[model samples]
Target: MLTQTRNVEEKLYFNRFVVDAGRPHITVRPHERPSAELRSLTHMCPAGCYSQNEAGQVEIATDGCLECGTCRIVTARTGEVEWNYPRGGFGILYKFG
Candidate 1:
């Protein structure tokens, strides 16, 4: 019998981010309608991935935003999110994910 040798030191990519339903308020309201128009019309949509700021402005989730760049371009008044730096340099690192 022989054991296979492998490199122990390496940077591994962990994809498949588990999107939590979060609290009841975080999840889509029961009466909410899933609309394609809404997805296209807003930077963050009513889906509320990145929450709104104190002034009712959307806060950017650039780190895990999938880089759609919609946060800056979307003309929606409520969904204009600002970017946040990667916390402690630990954030979403896309590696073919």
Candidate 2:
């Protein structure tokens, strides 16, 4: 049987992006407590940028974000994330057609 074997991370790596290192377009609520859904971001993010720190708080690294909006939707229940599109020339840039 023939089948394709490309993962989300692999595809993200191929795509180009201009990350605003100085400014993250997304941020998890530092004041609010973490919920299951928020914690899920660690695995849900295609870029694998969201993760738990030593303190067990959800931390997001927006650099590798695919701009897929998954985090915003997943964490909608708590509204613990502040998400916004990167500047006009920033963020993910899909090169493959």
Candidate 3:
């Protein structure tokens, strides 16, 4: 079987991208609270958008998000992650296309 040839973020770094500043499309509830279910999103998000802050709070940096919906799917059980698509013309854009 083939291994993960490259780190997820490393690969996403090569693609063209755009980030909106106003509001994040993805958000975590109970800002200071921690959840085992949501914590796993840090490893599952392909773009490495989900992570824990120094305070141990779940942080969702949507800029690099690949919009893969993996985070939404993983956190669906708890309904704590607010997931939605970015407004039109926002978020990632592939350069080659």
Could you say which candidate leads in lDDT?
Answer: 2
Find the 10 residues in a row with the least total lDDT in model 2.
4-13
Best by TM-score: 2
Candidate 3 global lDDT: 0.79
Model 2 CA deviation exceeding 4 Å by range: 1-10
TM-score to true structure, per model? 0.30, 0.84, 0.77
Candidates, ranked, lDDT: 2, 3, 1
- Give me candidate 1's TM-score against the actual structure: 0.30
Model 3: how far residue 72 lies from native, Å: 0.5
Best-to-worst ranking by TM-score: 2, 3, 1
1 against 2, candidate with superior TM-score:
2
Model 3 Cα shift for residue 83 (angstroms): 0.6
Model 2 quality (TM-score)? 0.84
Error of 2 at 14 (Å): 1.8
- RMSD of every candidate to native, in Å, equals 11.3, 3.4, 5.0
Stretches of candidate 1 exceeding 4 Å from the true structure: 1-63, 75-79, 85-88
